[model samples]
Target chain A: MTRLLGWILRYGIAALFVVAAVFPLAWMAVAGFKAKTEVVATPFQFFPEVWRWDNYTQLLADESFLRSLGVTFAGAVLFAALSLTVNALGAYAFARLDFAFKRILWVVVITTMFIPGIAIMLTSFVVVTQLGMLDTLAVLVIPGAASGMQVFFLRQYYLGVPVALEEAAQLDGAGPWRIFTRIFVPLSKGAFVVVGATSFLAFWNAYVWPVLTITDPELFQVQQYLATFRSDRASEMGLLMAGSTLAALPVIVLFLIFQRQIIAGVRITGLK
Target chain B: MAVTTLRAPARDTRSRGRPAGRGRRRETKAALIMLAPLLILLGIFVIWPLLHAVYISFYTWSFYEAPVFVGLENYLTVLTDQEFVDSVVRGLAFTAMVVPAQVAVAFLFANLVKSVSRKTAAVLKVTIYIPAVISEVIAAIVFSLIYAYRGGILNWFLGLLGREDTAWLGETSTALPAVAVPAIWIGMGVASLIMLAGLLDIPEAYYECASLDGAGPWTKMFKITLPLMKNIILFLLVTGFAASLQFLVLPLIMTQGGPVDSTTLPNLFIFRHFTNDLYIGYSIAAALLLFAVLGAVSALIFRLVRSEKAVDG
Candidate 1:
């Protein structure tokens, strides 16, 4: 009886959480194939009576959404690469190299990690306007280029890397940059992917910052355009689901591929 | 711990160098080269803006108008504005509800995931974290449909049990809690993952000993797990509070802070004041107020934690 109780206790909560997590995602995917009537039906049809593949085709037909999708994809890719490169270099300095003010610099980086960006957003907007970056992709990607949180996480990973390897490289006459690019970076692939892929997902899903900065229809991102489309076609659950399903796929697929590494990295680092 | 371990070996390498001063200079040069990009970017984008906002808070500058210095007027205006005050209160209320629910559910889920087989644990962990990977936009949209009045999923399920359709997001009283559900759902995934990391850090030998002493799972959790995971729990509480306080996406997309502004959060309130009113200084003032509060709380927590074991610089 005790064994049975333990089994039930463990599996019951696991099953409940799985259903809760997967339900909306599964519903979104399934409902994208649904007819407009079936999606909003009173009884909440468990399955679509007729699979409407055209729901996707119709959504793709929208010029603005397609443009926004392309823009957001390119922007996220760039943002991820930009932040990863800049932050990794900084992390390497903090983790591997000794220099004047090293401790002070680490303190500075750690201190700024907790400062919320939105609290200074109004003035940041002013600064962006002064630099004439408004409505440009540069504004979207550049502001987040040197995020302290990224540097902090990367530094934690770099600390665990064997210093003996860098010393061996030093004995062989490899400079910091050469050793970093050729040896340190390649060996730290797990950390890099976790940082890069997660940052990519974050940039792709970014809503408020883009909304505040970008106004050009040409440069409007996925979240911005989808929001516009949402307000415009509020009652069109079928189209909205189709759009959301399509928008959500790349990230979900990416997350699945990197699932183990991401979870393992978080556990090892033990920091957000 | 990381600082000392990372630096000690590098210093040893330097002492074995041909010339100590030159090696030191070279390292400094390399450090500067590598750190320049990040420093320049952060200075222009983050630090400078923060200081400038402090300067702007004392002035009066609507978007179209030139700035006129009026010391403390903007702060006074925000303090006296009932709507702004209410928004701050609402944001705190949301955080109070969200932080605990997230922390508790995360603690429970993490323990349950640990009890399962290795394969099941991995699968369960991934599945639970999947929602967090989904964007807030999609989450809001999906939840909105479920909460919609006519032909909505919630009402549909209710009607199957012979109940009438009720407006979920359409009513003021229900709107905040309605929005809170999605926030919690999306939030739990990350919270549980973080909690799992903490849980995994504890040794199985400790639990085995507890069980040998006649402790059940609940007793083991309270006696052994809770105390060991104190740091993790505290970290989760602080970070969770910050995230919940800054939540704007769900309410922005779902209700637009509507149904009589019942769901207007601090971030949304400041954003709408600037966007709707176009008063830049006032917005800056409101933002500074939030920054000060968060900073003070963080400093207090740091002090409390430091009194236990100091964080090395």
Candidate 2:
């Protein structure tokens, strides 16, 4: 009886934690299909009386919403690509190269890793403004492209790549660039994919940075755009819920498709 | 070893007519090419901004106003401002709540998952990690609904248990903790994953030996698990603390530092001063102070970790 009780307690707690993690998101998705009035109705409408597609369909048709989504989508893609290239190249050099000031340069990168992004928020915006990159896609994608953590992770990965392969390629007269592209890039696809996928999710979900920087309605990120309607918490509440759902759907889908990499990405990017 | 041997001897024989300096120069050039883009971007975006933030913290600049160099006046203002002081204290309290809770939750979730069957653990891990992946705005939105007075999930569940409705975000006292709940929810998973990695990394043999010695689960954990995973636990605490220091999104979205500014944590204060109020110098000074505190704490932890390692090294 005691052992059975223990088993029950263990799994029960586990189940509770999982439910707590997922319950809010699941409700948001469900409430997206409910009428705005029905969302906050008496007896707590757990399910919609009539499923509504108007919220999503209307957002798809709305020019402002579409523009925001387009910026976010394109920004995420460009960020992932740019971040992957910059960090991967730096990592490759750090791992494999014999170069001048390598130690000093690497120390700089690692030290900057400890300086939290929030700490530098004001100055970064000032720098971007001075550079005339404000309200443009360049501000979103370019400034965040280079990452110390990514470079570090990829460098660690490259260190594990066999020197023998590179030596053989060297023997075959392949240049350093060719060897990197043909050999290291192909071999480190897992690491690169992990970085790229996380970068995409990060840019997609980014709320604070865009909120601070972007004022142009045309260039508003998806999350910032949705935040505007949140104060409109009138009868359009369900529609707002639907907007939140749509904003989060891609990441959820991405997580499901590449969960293994994404989970590894969490460890890769979350903590040192 | 084999590759180095073959390549090393073959290289000298193959390039006997050429000096090693030529190859060294080529490798250096290649490395420079590879590193240029990253270095340039980091210089502009990361390094220079940090320097400039410190530089601007000394000036008096606001929205539509020219920046005037005011020496150390901004720093003085940040130090004396009562609102800023209250926010920092609230932020510390929030950190105090979040850091320990995150470490505990991560420990609890990690150990539970570690004890389960592999398949079940995998499934549970994925679902439980959902909050970490979702955006802060969406999470905050869902949570706001959950805390809604009329039709909130929390109040509904409480009402089922015959409890009274509480204005969680609307009440001055409850607003901070209410805001902190989602912070823990969002941050705890990755900390758990780190802890899980640390847990899995322990040699199964150590636990087996402890079990053979009639060790209880708690005993085994304290004796075998905790001691081995000290570094990882320390890491999670410091990292989680740093993360919670930047607690802005939820408070910004959910409360707007409402109920008489009770939910205004440090980051929210800095953000408001920077963007909303556009007190650039004061905000930058406050941010730099925050940066200094973070740096000092991190440095202190490294010192602690290093000293601990000396005894155990």
Candidate 3:
């Protein structure tokens, strides 16, 4: 009887978790196809009585949605590429090269993780404005182009690479830059992809920074655009759900493809 | 521990170098070249803004007029402000609710998954972790539909239970909790994975020995699992607390700290003052205070974790 009770408890809790994790997202996707009348009807409908494609069609045809989508795509790609290159180089230096004040410099970099962006945002806003980056796409990518976490994470991975490979390259008269690009970068490809995907997801999902920095509607990223679109069309639940689905699709797809690397990345960086 | 082990051998090799000075200079030049982009960006954006935040906290400037020196006046005003105090309390309350709930739920799920087969565990982990990859903004929007009043899913469930539909996010009493639901749900995936990693790290022999000694499941869990998982628990708590304290995006989009400011986190409070009221200095002061609190809490967790490790050793 006790063993039976334990089996029930185990599966029961697992069932609850699966439901909680999947239901809201599944409902949102279902609701996007829901008709306007069905969405507001009392005694809520789980699946739409009549699946409507108008929400998706209308959102696709909308100028602002298209523009914001373009901006989001470009911004995420650019931010990921720029940050990966810069952070990988910095991480390589920390992991391999000898330098003055290396320990203190690394400490300084890690300390920035403790300084929450909210604390420095006001001044960051002022600095960006002074640099004439406000209301521009550069505001979305440039300020966050170098993350302390990315550097620390990549450095940890780079440190695990065998020094004999680099030593052999040095004996063959290869320079530091050549050794890093040929040996370190290629070996740490998995870490690079992890960092790149994370950076991309971060930029894609960004809300507050974009909202605070960009005033122009055309310049808005998908998330900022979605929030404002929701507020503007608050009464239209169908269209709003559609917008949320569209905004969430890219990251969802990315996560599905790269789930293993992402999970490994979290374990490595998060634990240490 | 891994960091020290990895760093030791690298240092040993460098210490026995032949052409030490010339090699060091070349390495330094290469390092500087590689690090230039990171340093320049950090200098302009991160480091400068951090210093400027401290500097601006002591002055009253609204961008239209020249800065006027206030010298602790902004700090005093922010400290005594009732709204600021309430925001901090609400933030702490949110953190209190989120951290424990997430840790417990995550722990439960991790333990449950461990009892299953390896193939089943892998599939379960992926499904549960999917929500965490979705952005906070998207998660909040998704939950808004779930919590919607008229045709909302929650109300629909309430109808089945013969209970009256409540405005989950529209009332003061329920607003904070409602906002917290999505935060906890989205957080469960990552937290569970961390906990699962910790659980899997334990040797199978420990459980087998416990079973031979006639320990029940509960005893094995509490006496063996929990004690061994303390470090992972500490990691989850610290990161969870810090993340909760900086909660902004969900609240910003969902309620705008609405229904009489009931869900106003300190970050949101600062956001409103800086953007809407244009009280830049005041907002910076409040933000600084929030940072100090987070720092202290983090330090406490670090010390606790370190001491626990020492005792284990």
Candidate 4:
């Protein structure tokens, strides 16, 4: 009896966890396919009554939603590409090159990782405004182009590269840049993908900075655009749910593709 | 060793061709070129703003007129304000609630998943981790539906159980806890993944030895597992606490720090001062104070971990 009880207890908890983790999202997806009246019906509908496809169509037809989607896609691609290049170069230098103040510079960068972004919000905004970057895509792409954590992770990956490869390149009269491009870059594709995907997801889902910086609706990112649905049209559950689902679709797709790399990256950094 | 032999001749030729000082200068120049973009961005976006935040904390400004210097007044105002004090208390309360709940649940789930079959474990891991991939804004919106008083799923379940439905997000008493639920849920997946990695790192021999010594699962876990996973737990704790202190998006979207300022975190408080009241200096001052508190707490946790390591060593 005790053995049976323990088995039940163990799997029971696991079942509860799985349900809790996934049910809300599934329910939200269902609600996105729900009609307006069916969503707020007296007895909450577990699934949509008719599976209305018009919710998505209507959301897609909205200019603000389309604009936000375009802005988010463009900004994420630019931010990810720029940050990957910058972080990779910096990581390579830290990992393989000998330079003055290298250790001190790295420590300084790492220390800023702990300072919460809210603490610097006012000054960052002021600087952006002063530079006339506010309400522009540059506001989203430039400031976050050099993440300390990304550089640190990529440096860790680069350190694991065989030094003998670079040595061989040197024998062929290759310079540091050549060895970096020819050897390290190709070998560290996994690290680059991990960092790039993670950075893109962060930029795409960014809420606080974009909300504070961008006042014009045309320039709003997806999360900020979704927030307007909440504040302005709280009664429109179907529209809101559809918008939320659409906003989340890109990252969800990316996560499915890059889940292993993302998890391994987190583990390596966490363990360190 | 063969590569080292090859590198010796290359090193010799390079040194013979170029003076050591010139080589060093070239290496430094290349490194500087590579590092310039990162350094410049960090200087302008991170380091400068940090210093500028401290400077602006002492001045009164609203982003329109020139910032008038009012040394220490904004700090005094922030320090003395009852609402600011309440926000800090709420923030601490949220962190205190979330960090332990998240870490404990994560540890539990990690262990449970580890006991399962390999394929089942993989599926469970992905299912649990899916939430972490979703944005905080969407997570908040999903839970707002769950907590909705009229047609909420939670209330719907309550109705099935013949219980009265409560306004989870609308009540002052329940609002903070309601907000914390999603925070804990969203953070669980990453923390558990870290814990799972730590668990897998432990040698199987230790558990086998424990079982040979007539140890039960509980005994083995407490004696073998938890002690070995101390560093991972500390990592989760410090990062989770720092994140909870800056909790804004969920509460802002779900409750707007509402009902009676119950869910008003420090970040939300700072945001309100800057945007609604236009007290930029005061807002910056409050944020700086929060930063100091988080830094001190993190230092304390690190010190504790270090001392534990010393004891172990």
Candidate 5:
């Protein structure tokens, strides 16, 4: 009975996850094949009587959806690159450099972790607007390019890298740049991968700043567009679901590929 | 190891500026050089914006009017406003309701995951974490479909049992909790992952002894697990509180913070004021207040967690 109970509990939790995780996607998928009447009909059917391929066709025909996808993709990729570069160097400094006020500076940076991003977003908007970057992808990625959590996590991982490797490169009379490029960069690939994964996921999924900064529908990232689309009930539910499914596709792929690194990074960052 | 140490081999080396210190200076310079771009980025992105935000919070301004310094008046108005008060009350209530539910469910799920084989654990982990990866807006859309008034998948499933269709999102009573359903759904996976990490940190020796002493799984869990996982629990409590306090997107998308502002959170209120120009000063004031509350809560959590860690140690 005890063994049976344990088995039941294990399957129970697994079922919970499976249901919770896949149901939304499943609903989206099922609903994509559903018509408007079938979508709102009483005694909801999981499967539609008629598979409407027109939903996909209609969504594909929408220029706004395509543009939003392009904008989101570009912003996410650029932000990921910019954040990764900044985090890599900053983390290297904290881990290896003998700088004045190192501990104080580190504390300052890490404390920013506790300050919620939304609090600073208003100021970010003002600055971005002043700089004439509003309604552009630069505004989307530039203000949030550096994150304290990313820097701190990278620093932790960088500490695990052998310090002697850098010393050896220096012995060859390598310039600081050369030493960093040759010795540290290659060795810290794991940290880079982890940081890059988190950065990408964050940038891709960002909604608030994108909504605030970009007033032009042409500049709307996938999340913002999908949100606005969902808000309008007149828009076909199937097409909206299809777009949402498409928006999630890249991150889902990224997660599958780098699940270990991403999970480890999340766990480490969340510890603080 | 000795060979690798040549790059900057000084463990106890004090200053690298003098005759022997040249190498230290070089390494330090390199470190600064590497870190320069990041500092510039952080200064532009994080620090400057934060200072600007605080500055703007003190002023009465919208996009239309030039910002006028209102000092503490904006704050006073925000604090005394009935709507603001109601929003804060509702936000706290939601946090109070949701945090315990998410944490408990997550712990249960994590323990279940640990019992399975590595392969099954991986599959479960992927499934659970999928929601965590999806954007909040997308998750809201997904749930909106599930909680649709008449034709939602959930209501359809319920219809098999001869239950009447329920308007999950349309009703004031069900709206906030209904929105929270997705928030908790996505949150459960992240929470479970955190708890699993804590579970792994537990030493095997404690579990072995409990089993040898004839403790069943329940006894072992209570006696050995929860005590060992206290720090982990506290960590979740603090961060979860901080994150949930900013709950805006789910409610914004699902109910627009309504069925009569029943679901309007503090952050959504801030969003509303900031966007509309009418409440710019008031919004800033609300945001600052939210920030102050969050700061106080986090500090309290920090002190509590530290004390607990010390006691456990």
Candidate 6:
């Protein structure tokens, strides 16, 4: 009886998760294939009698949607690479290197985690404006370059790494950069993957800053893009759903591929 | 405990070097050099903006106008504003609702997932975590359709129970809670994963002893699991509160903080105010107010929950 109850408990929660996670995604997929009138019809149809693939076709046909997709793609890719590179370098420093204000600097960096994103948003906007980066991808990427949380997470994991590995490299006449590149970087691949996944997700889901910074429909990222398109053309529910489905696809793909590493990263980073 | 083991080798390495003191100093300086870029970046971006934001909160400025010294006016205005006050209250309530629900569900899910096969657990976690990674806009749109009155999937399912279609987003009563459900859903996967980590950290000896003493899973969880996971739980409480307080996208994209602004969270309230030039300073003031509330709550939690061991930090 106890064993049976345990099985039920596990399966029950699993079923709830399936319903919560999969159903909406499935409904969105079905909605993407839905017709205009059928979408707003009196009763919801679990499966649409007609699979309107034209919804995707029509959505793809839109110059704005296509442009926004291009904007989102370019912005996300750039944002990920820049954030990942900057964070990695910063993390390396905090992890391996000792500076004049090493303890103080790490404390200060970690302290920034307490600074709410909205608090600094106005100044960041001002900074971007002064740098003449307003309404551009530079504004999007540059302000978001320094992730304090990433630095702290990376530094914590790096603390677990043995110093002798790098010392051994130094003994073999490896320079600082070479030691970092060959030894530190290769050894911290797990941390790197976690940080990369986080940066990707952060940049991809960014909405407020993008909405404020970019006004041109052509330059909007995915969330902003969807909001603009939906608000402008609510009549095309089918097309909007299609656009939303596409917007959701990449992150889902990433989550599926990096589930274990990402979960491990969450274990480290979440507590921190 | 691990510190002694780590330091002993470093001490030995120090003794083997000629002119060890100067050599160590030189290496330390080299480490500082490699660390320069990060230090500079943090100073300029994190520290500077933080202080600047507080400074700006005291001034009256639109992007067009030079900021005028407003003294306490901005703060007073934000305090007195009806909409701002309401939104802050609503935000707090939302956090109160979402945090506990998320923590509980996450714990339950983590417990369930632990016993499953590794492959099954991976599949389950990936499935669950998909919502967390999904962009708020897409999820909002999807949920909007699900909660839509006429032809929405949820109401369609409800119709099978012979109940009339009820408006999920259309009604003021259901609007805020409607928005919060998804917030909790997105949060659950992350929370569960965090709890699972904490659960994994617990030594098997405690559980084994508890079971030998005739403790069931319930007692074991309360006595063994909960106490051991306290730090992780506290961390979740702080982070979860922050995330819930700052939630804007769902309400913004889905409800537009509508049905009489019943769902207008503080973040969305601030965002809307900033977007409209007439009330920009007021929005900043409200935002600062929110910052204070969150900071206070966090400090309170830290104070209340801190163990004797945590006092050093």
| TM-score against native, each model | 0.93, 0.92, 0.95, 0.93, 0.91, 0.90
Ranking by lDDT: 3, 4, 1, 2, 5, 6
Task: Evaluate all candidate structures by whole-model CA lDDT and list the values in order.
Answer: 0.82, 0.82, 0.83, 0.83, 0.76, 0.75
**Least lDDT summed over 10 consecutive residues: which range in candidate 4 chain A?**
A263-272
RMSD of each: 3.1, 4.8, 2.7, 4.8, 4.4, 3.9
Q: How much is B27 displaced in model 5, in angstroms? A: 3.8
lDDT (10s digit) by residue, model 2, range B155-175: 877888999998889999899
- Least lDDT summed over 10 consecutive residues: which range in candidate 5 chain B? B1-10
TM-score of chain B of 3: 0.91
Say which docking band candidate 6 falls in. Answer: acceptable
lDDT (tens digit, per residue) of candidate 3 on B148-230: 78778788888899988889999999999999998998888888887887788799999999999999888998999999988
**Alpha carbon deviation, residue B55, candidate 5 (Å):** 2.7
Candidate 2, residue B64: CA error in Å? Answer: 5.5
Better of 3 and 5 by lDDT: 3
Ranked by DockQ, the better of candidates 1 and 5 is 1
Model 6: residues with Cα > 4 Å off, grouped in runs: A61-63, B1-44, B296-313
Q: What is the interface RMSD of each candidate, in Å?
A: 4.4, 7.4, 3.8, 7.6, 6.7, 5.4
Model 2 chain A, poorest ten-residue lDDT window? A263-272
Candidate 1 structure quality by residue, lDDT tens digits, A1-272: 98999799788888888988899889888888987777877667868888889889987897877888899899989988999999999999987787888888777666666667777777778788989999999999899878887787787567766667767888888888988898778876777788898788888899988998999999998888778879987767788899999899888899899998877755544432
Model 6 collision count: 0
The model with the greater lDDT, 4 or 5, is 4
Per-candidate DockQ values are 0.52, 0.48, 0.53, 0.49, 0.50, 0.45
Tens digits of per-residue lDDT for model 4, B283-304: 8888998788887677566556
lDDT of each residue in B194-263, candidate 6, tens digit only: 7886787688899999999999988998898888888777778787988899998999988999999989
lDDT of 6 at A156: 56
By DockQ thresholds, what CAPRI class is model 5?
medium
- State residue A121's C-alpha deviation in candidate 1, in Å: 1.6
lDDT of 6 by residue, A154-184 (tens): 6556556666676777778776578778976
